[model samples]
Target: MTDFLRRKLIQAAGSAAALGPFAIGSVSAQQKGDIVIAASQPITGIFAFAGTAMNNGLNDFVLWKNANGGVAGRKLRYVSEDSGFKLDQGVAIFKKLMASEKPSFFYGDSTQWAKAVAQDAVAAGTIMTSSTSLASSMADPTGMPQHFVPGPIYGSMHEILMEYIAKTWSKSDKPKIAYVYADTEFGRDGIPAGKARAEKLGLPIVTEIVTKQAGIDVAPEVAKLRRARPDIVIFQGYILAPMPEFVRQMREAGLQSQVMGTAWGLDKPAYDALGAMGESLAGVSPYRYGHETDSTMINAMRDFGAKNRPDMKNISPFYISSWLSGMVFAEVADRCIKANKPLTLPNMKAALESMKEWDSGGIFGTLVDLSKHQAPVGRIYRYEPKTKTMEPASSWLKV
Candidate 1:
């Protein structure tokens, strides 16, 4: 991680710790006067960049809420641990937090971790959970009532991208599609649905390539893609590193296929990494970028950063995603309070599921509905190397 990001993370940790528990020894049973919010984040691993941004956003939101007298007159006590983006570590952190903090709300690091602890979370009966993951499996209301997402599931996002590809394809041309993903739960989560959606749209999926999340050499995968001669290739389960390398290698190999990515692959960092090669890149995003000053939520967050974190210059999409997730939690807590309901897991679940047309202050372009526990809305964006930013390629599509 960069020195700037490291310092920002340290500052965020200190600020959150000041308002709540920082260690297991400092935490006791949940107090009636405090609302504990615990999380497991990938603060020091393959996803450190994203995890640090997410942690910063979550801490900023918690601190902002506390400064504003908190929700329902109850101060939110934020606590978190690093999971290193490892499922075992994530599960262990969840168990430790539950036992030590007895938190009412939990933020998970990955979909695998959320799935691992879903039954336990339900059995616990009082704790509600959200995650960085937008896996379709986590949206099950009957089985995972206490778990929710801030945006559309990976499958839904994949479908939206597929629909875009289909709509844009010429009637006389049959576009060949390729799927490249990492060998992780996140990398593979959307494949089945993406394949089905492609079949339904009559887009022929020519190949599927599996690569490491942080692969250094993608020549082999690029070779496969070159041979397949896909019209478009979609990447999944990567944040910054490997995808750019893949794109660079593909370009060097004279591959003409247009590259698209899912949420994880759609960010400024990726564009910055791709450099001039990113001009042809396009992807889908659940929320607007931090540089998108037109958004009320982005403007508000920028103002917050100027006042509180003057040293930080750029806010990435990962940060906005985490901040929006915090907003969702706060909104649900406020709703439960207004309804005169106890702030328990079940009440929180009800409040989340009941959300409809909830304005996110332009965090999401349209009103949010959580009837399915996922925001079924997103937009396509193409990266512009000349401007070094992602420009909207399509209006928000509701899937």
Candidate 2:
């Protein structure tokens, strides 16, 4: 193996050791210094909007850590690559990230690609945290400890959102519902899961529609949904794909539904693209920028935005969530260093496993219950286009 892949395998294996009592072997001086991290994201293709924000968030956290005196005298050095939201590209990047770049951990670009890379990352013994807040085959209980999803899974969020709709319009005559999604594994995962939950709640699912990534040729789908005169419509797709186009076309076609989206669908760029029509669109999201009370972290984000991305006005919830993920990783790294554990994957994973009810000072309050190797806690937020912001929709949702 190349030097970089060797380091990645060691880091992943170390994380497994942390889960148990296994001991990790030491590395030479070259791979023995600072904790190196990498992120692979969609910067040029369908997932670009969210991917760009996630990358910026990762970079910002590393800068913040370095400015704050570094994590235990070892500054975090992070890198990111654009994968274009292609599965082949994603697989290739993982091979490179593992075999050449040698990062201690990786943050996934999207849910679809997360599934593709998690297996390889696990086999290589490296830890990967995903912003793809969807439950999938990768979330199977038998999976290894290579993955961490610190947000409300798509299946769970869909159930709750459907329940909320049922309760909110309970007094009215039976309300019809419609579902629109992309034509991908990530999209297909939501259909069965949402249908099962909606049926369990006795909510009538009137129309089910799917569209491709190229553009919104969803007129036929909308016509079918309009025939049902649905009261609720849920979209499962990406910010840069057919979602905004769907909203615009559906609205222009004079078919109005109480439109909401899955976790990945809502963000500032999506809202901006849809213009005034975006007002009716809402969805479940993982983080909120203005809701933060951690003056330290919030101020840092504000300063960074002002200095670097002044034109990018609204820092969406996912952006903050991505930043928080890196912060949590840094905290784990700090713990491992304080304990004199080597800053490899195994030691860092061990430190994370040791944490319980970690108060990430302000922006994060979820308990890191690693006993089951799952992020057992999350929160839900709703967006308001009038304000162009996401507000807390519920208290922390826990498993």
Instruction: Evaluate all candidate structures by whole-model CA lDDT and list the values in order.
Output: 0.81, 0.65
Worst 10 residues of 1 by lDDT: 22-31
Candidate 2 lDDT score at position 162: 66
Where does model 1 exceed 4 Å of error?
Answer: 1-32, 86-89, 214-217
**What digit string (tens of lDDT, one per residue) describes model 1 on residues 220-270?**
788999999898989898877687677778878888788889887887667
RMSD of each: 9.0, 5.1
Q: TM-score winner among the candidates?
A: 1
The per-residue C-alpha lDDT of model 1 at residue 391 equals: 81
Lowest summed lDDT window (length 10), candidate 2: 22-31
Leading candidate by lDDT = 1
What is the per-residue lDDT of model 2 for residues 258-356, given as tens digits with 9 covering 90 to 100? 777766576656655654554545666544444354545666787788888888676666677678778767777678657755545555556766766
Q: How far is candidate 2 from the true structure (C-alpha RMSD, Å)?
A: 5.1
